[model samples]
Target: MNNNPRQLAFIILQEIHRKQAFADFALDKYLRKNDLIDANRRLVTELVYGCVRRERSLDAIIDELAKKKSHQQNPDLRIILHIGLYQLSYLEQIPESAAVDTTVELAKQNKF
Candidate 1:
């Protein structure tokens, strides 16, 4: 799997959803284990927690835009889309291009 912040966020989401893991615990575990730089660590934290916080709304959007329902989408792709949509809708400081590019890269990695 890819190791960029976006990819890491997707993995964290997968752990939370698939393993029924606590968001904070999964995030902290990955943060500690990965040796990510400060910016990436912060981004991962934001994406993981942000996605968790806004999951319902994000899924609503996913349901509208995606051909497949959220549950039917690849788990990895769902998480990646969550991160991308979260960044687009909530984190205005992030450039749209960067968010879309990273998310697309993540989807590609997962063969979405």
Candidate 2:
């Protein structure tokens, strides 16, 4: 679509969060449906799987960061936290500011 890699990742995360679909299946289906090519397709692949794999730990970090006793947030916020923390913990090549800003923006846009 018109969105960048990070934005696409965020949208995919939301879809996975909302649809209750398997991340791999959803990502694969999405990849095949979209016009993503070459490295960007690879980025989307990594983005989806990486975020899904580390979802629990990401939730813990986000709960801690938000100073909460537990992760009792909405599913959309869960998606946001998962991607944000995935980038924070693993995607070291991407700047932390970009990750956090985009995650917050995505959450806001989704009304999370």
Best by lDDT: 1
Q: What is the TM-score of each candidate against the true structure?
A: 0.91, 0.78
Off by over 4 Å in 2: none
lDDT tens digits, residue span 1-112, model 2: 5335656777777778777788888777677667876887877778789988887777778767775533577666666677777877898787999878977886777676
Give the per-residue lDDT digits (tens) of candidate 1, residues 6-72: 8788888899999999999999888877878898898889999999999999999999998999978
How many residue pairs clash per model? 0, 0
**Cα misplacement distance, residue 97 of candidate 1 (Å):** 1.1
Worst 10 residues of 1 by lDDT: 1-10
What are the root-mean-square deviations of the candidates from the true structure over C-alphas?
Answer: 1.7, 2.3
User: lDDT (CA) for every model shown?
Assistant: 0.88, 0.74
Model 2, residue 15: displacement in angstroms?
3.9
lDDT of 1: 0.88
